[model samples]
Target: MQKTKLKALTKILGQTALIALITFVMSEITLRIYNKINPSFVFYDSSYNRFRGKPNAPDYDFKLNSQGFKDVEFTVEKPAETYRILGIGDSFTYGVVPYQYNYLTVLEEKLNKSGQKTEVINMGIPGMGPRDYLSILVNEGLKLNPDRVVLSFYIGNDFLDNYMTANLRTEEKSYMIALIKSMIKIQSNYKGKVLNPTTVQYNDNLPTFTDEKYLEDTINKSNMFVRNPADGMFKGFVDDAVKDLIKIKQICDSQNIPLTIVIIPDEVQVNSQLQKQVKQAFDPNNQNLLDFEISNRLLTEQLQQANIDYLDLLPDFKATAQKTPLYKPNDTHWNIAGNRLAAELITQHLTAKNQP
Candidate 1:
């Protein structure tokens, strides 16, 4: 009886192991194909303080270069008579739209179209902040010998992004496990909300963004805009962000590379209609509760003191926000129109300096 039972147990164990192996192989194959359509783009690396793109991740639309960034592979030896600008920032710089529609791409095309040979390298990574920008510049940016560095500072959550990165858990290294986790997380989050390149593929159509809960959450989450960066509820994040920005400037100056900080304004600060809604939901009675431009004013003040050459896009964006759709509905990042506007403005500014 004992011999018979032992043999039966061994047979069961072997069957289970075979089944598990088959399941793992099938799951890996499925994930690899899914990644082809919407790549599992960015990952948290032990080597860096922030999230970076998955190297050579090619989706249906765009491919991250060999360096794990949105732009093409960059060689340290820049071509002669070619001007290269290292574009830096978070998702806005990494881009939520198609690759060709990003401001960096548009800016490069516009500059080249006007007869000046220029290469605008997109060094932007999603979920990055001032500190991450500084890190990338130190690690890979300076080696490229860029002529200029234009760092795009989004007003929405850069300060918050900088602060929260310290607490985020690193993602799994295994592709199948990572993809499974990513899918589960995406489904758990609000519907129609695009989080990362891995979550959703870029499209020309806008998302269904009328989820009031998402709007309220976005307001409370990004409410740092309602006060001065120095004295507000988000003082710690603001201070940390500023210190990193100053360090970035110092590094660029040390290398004799001109750094231009492009301040991308938040939509709440610029949109009065949205402000009314925010006021009602967030502060029912106070008309003056939200101070939209205070963040821009305070941040720019620090930049001026540091003598950092900066471009405040608030005015231009405000002037154009209503007439043109700058931000995607309910989403903090810019849509296609917003990208085009920024490209146009930056191109005008850059070209204005060289024109006779």
Candidate 2:
């Protein structure tokens, strides 16, 4: 009886092992197939501070050059008679739109069309902040021998991100686990409501607002920066960010590379209707509202003190937004129109500076 029972147990164990092996093999195959079909995934680089888009991704028809940047291959030794500008920033610089439609590409085209040989290498990575920008410039950007370095400073969350850098890390997960999680919708994209005036409901007579909750949250967090600069948390972030920018300037100055800091305003800043909505939502009882430009003014003051060449896009974006939508209705990043306008402005500035 004992021997018979032992043999039965062995048979059951063998069958279970075989089933597990088959399941693992099937999962591996499915994951490979899924990755091939959908390549718009971002992977964590242990070396970099944030996630990087998958190299040679097919989903967005995106291709990462050898250095993992979403740009064409470039040599450390820049070619003669060719001017290269390294654009570094967060997603606004990386651009959600197609590579061809990106502002950097448009800037390059506009410059080249005007008989200036230029190459704008996009070193922008999504979710990066001033700290990462400084690091990338010091560690990698200087090696490329760029003539100019353009830093696109998105004011939405860069200060917050720079202050809260301790929590940034890429999780370690196996391919099978990643595939399973993705299949089950465990990974989700951020869905911030667009504050563009044209897309939201507006009543000329009645006070109307959309995404009051988001607006409230934004106000609660960011209002301190404008209203109370002496707040410890806000002061800390500003100090660190200024230090990072100063470091960036020092590096560029040492290398004899012209650094241009482009200040990108928040969505609400450019949309007057949205600005009104924000005021209504955040302070319904009061007629006076804090100027949203306070944040930009603070940064501008620092740049001026440091003698950093900077351009604020709020005025230009505000003017252009009056005629057409510059940002997507559902997303925070710029649309094609915004990208084109930015390119035009940057082209005009650079060309003017380049002129004898």
Steric collisions counted per model: 1, 0
Flag clash pairs in model 1. Answer: 41-54
lDDT string for model 1 (1-356, tens) is 99999999999999999999999889877766765554544333333433566777764367788877888777889988889899999888987777888999999999999886888999887777787888889988899898899999988888777666676554465566776777776766546644344556766555545557556766786567554444555766767888999999889988888888999987776777877778787778876767778778878988999899888999998988778778877677788999999999898888776720
Q: For model 2, how does the per-residue alpha-carbon lDDT over 240-315 read when each residue is reduced to its tens digit?
A: 7888899999999999999899888777778777667667766777636557777788888889999998889988
TM-score: model 2 vs. ground truth? 0.74
Lowest lDDT sum, 10 consecutive residues, model 2, at: 201-210
Candidate 1 lands at a TM-score of 0.78
- Model 2, global lDDT: 0.73
Q: What stretches of model 2 exceed 4 Å from their correct place?
A: 1-49, 167-221, 229-232
